[model samples]
Target: MFTKILVALDRSPMGKQVFEQALALAKATGASLMLLHVLSAEEEGSPYAPLLTNFDYYPGVGSQSFEHYQKQWDNFKNEGIQLLQSLSAQANTAGVNAEFTQQLGSPGRLICQLATTWGADLIIMGRRGRSGLKELFLGSVSNYVLHHAPCSVHVISVPSQVTQAEEAPQETASVN
Candidate 1:
């Protein structure tokens, strides 16, 4: 009974699973999809800071380090846009109406805000399965959304094994 579905996505592999599940649900229920990507420094793999050793102060805007960091941030934002576009295209090709947006902010708050503003009937997102001390320190976006969202929230838990596999470095095969 969902008319509008909001799908929160990230760069992680689990994000694709979340989108696929949301797309299927939208197709089944004839619901429009809103694909959202929130850019935050807290996000895993974010290039929000430069790798400076023993740095005491923020890099000046005119400094080379700052310029390099800025370029990395810009590239990150562009990648997020490209991701959303690809997902939206996939949804459209599947005969589901879809729109996408990328915003820079706290993920949990932005997700709930968008859901409320868009009047989404449901929110579909992925959980990294963080727990205990890790969850306490890092904060879980799905957990926050589940408690604070204006609409029903469906959380897809990303298996720990899958996460580990994704993080592991790929080995190159030697051609004999």
Candidate 2:
């Protein structure tokens, strides 16, 4: 009996699965979708701003380095926007009303805040299997959202094997 569904997406492959599940649920429940992508340096493909050390505390290491970092950050934001637009399009094509927003902040906090502000009835997201020390150190966004979200949360757990495969670097075949 959900009226509004918020789908939190990242750049990972699991993001596609999360969107698909949300779309299916929205279609079935006749709920509108709010696709959200949170931009953070911690996310893959996002560039970290150059740190100012005691040795050189002007602005960054150099203006060139800062400029490069800025370019990468812009690209990361643009990519996130593109992804949200793509997902929204797919949902619309499936006859599900969909809208998207790309914001900069902690994923877990943003998801919960948006869910509350948007009045979402449910939040659907994917969780990369993280546990023990890793979970403690890095923190689990899904875990935080589940406990803090104003609405019900459905987490799609990505298998450990799948997560490992996605993390591994791809090999290219050399043409002889």
Q: Which candidate leads the pack in lDDT?
A: 1
List candidate 2 segments past 4 Å from native: 50-60, 164-176
Instruction: Note the Cα lDDT for every prediction shown.
Output: 0.90, 0.89
lDDT of 2 at 129: 86
TM per prediction: 0.85, 0.87
Per-residue lDDT of candidate 1, residues 47-71 (tens digit): 9874444343545434676668778
TM-score, candidate number 2: 0.87
Clashing pairs for predicted structure model 2, backbone only: none
Tens-digit lDDT track of model 2 for 40-151 = 7667677866372332466446777767777888888899999999989999999999999999889999999999999999999999887778789989999999999999
Give the number of the best model, judged by TM-score.
2
User: Candidate 2, overall lDDT?
Assistant: 0.89
